[model samples]
Target: METHRIEELERKIQEYETIISEMSAPIIPSIVPQTILIPITGLIRAERFDKIRGNVLNFIHNKDIETAIIDLTDISGERIEDVCLEEIGRELHELASSISLMGVKALFVGMNPELVKRMVLDGIKLESQSFSTFQAALKYLMKQKGLEFRKISE
Candidate 1:
């Protein structure tokens, strides 16, 4: 009886961890139609990246997302900072390519300048459309669709 209780507790703990991991990287819909924005933040481990990739791919497959904006501006944590920038860049590039193969345009935004410089130095070419900000990417996408936003006064 004691062993069974312990196993049940462990199983519950694993379930909670999976839920937290899923909550960490959320795929939000953008104002532009068929565009989804995924803001990646905090410590990025191999496991976390896997969760993000899986969730994004599942979301895209279910929805008619034409563009995916992967914003990495908030990817700054003590644990993540220790990881090699080159490795992260390579993984991101690979993810973009995978998304492209699925017929969705991947737009990487908010990349750190230092990281970008490192990628350039390492001769790692990004295959997706990159922008300095999410707004810029959204604006460009909206323009392509002949859509414009007008400011309204209260």
Candidate 2:
């Protein structure tokens, strides 16, 4: 009947939304061994934070990841206020703590300076090692592994 079709469509839409949400937070393994990078974009709501935490935990639990780089470069400071920034900072701190407990070093990269200042002004302390860019984090990891990169000319 019409009602049954509508219900099926609704269920499908919900399923798609869930899939999209999960895809938004991808845990990508870096070229360096035992390093995983998670690039976060868009507005990070409370629900999204939970999803991010769960996904990162689940993925790292199965992999031999010694370092996790959480990149927040794509998020703009103009889009979020100080209050929201504080909340997101707190969530990031929690995520970092959890990852540390699992024996993984969590490095936060690409944080907005303004937001970071605001968080600091609010007395929010971030325990994770932070870098201004993903490249910096990668370089640090490579150094830790005693690996060097040479530019190859085409």
Candidate 3:
């Protein structure tokens, strides 16, 4: 009887973990139409990237999204190892390619210099549109939609 109780608790724990992991990577629709952003947070892990890839692809598949901004501000060079970097880089490239094949453009934002340096040293060249910040990416998207930000009198 005690074993059965423990097993049920384990199952519930696993379910909660799955939910939390799913929440960690969300595809957020932008203020502009047909645009979405995926803000990647927390430690750089292949598992998290896997979830992001699946979620982005699936969400864009059914939706009429034209652009996807992948925010990488939370990843740092010091926190991730070479092997993990390689996997994440490869997956990122593949995810872009997949999104392209689906007729959606993918953009990267907030890539730290250290991570880029490590990727370059590792010979991982990921090709695609990348911005230094979310605002930059959003600016580009807005321009594409024929919108611009102007200073307004207070």
Using lDDT as the measure, which candidate wins? 2
Quickly count the clashes in candidate 3: 0
lDDT of 3 by residue, 1-154 (tens): 9999999999999999888887777778898789988887766666666677777888888779898888889888665644466677787788888888888998989888866776778788666899999998888888888987779999
The residue ranges of model 1 lying beyond 4 angstroms of the native Cα positions read 77-82, 152-154
lDDT per residue for candidate 2 within 7-66, as digits (tens), equals: 999999999988888877888989989999999876566778888999999998967899
Kindly indicate the candidate among 2 and 3 with the higher TM-score.
2
After TM-score superposition, the amount by which residue 13's alpha carbon in candidate 2 deviates from its true location, in angstroms, is 1.3
Model 1 agreement with the true structure over 25-100: per-residue lDDT tens digits:
8889899999999998767776677778878888888578899999987865354754677778888988898888
Q: Count the backbone clashes (under 3 Å) in each candidate.
A: 0, 0, 0
Model 3 — which ten-residue stretch has the worst lDDT?
77-86
Positional deviation of 123 in candidate 3, in angstroms?
A: 2.7
TM-score of each: 0.89, 0.91, 0.88
Against the reference, the lDDT scores of all candidates come to 0.84, 0.86, 0.81
- What ranking emerges by TM-score with the best candidate at the front? 2, 1, 3
What lDDT score goes with residue 12 in model 3? 100
With a 3 Å backbone cut-off (N, CA, C), the pairs that clash in candidate 2 are none
TM-score head-to-head 1 vs 3, winner: 1
Order the candidates by lDDT, highest first: 2, 1, 3
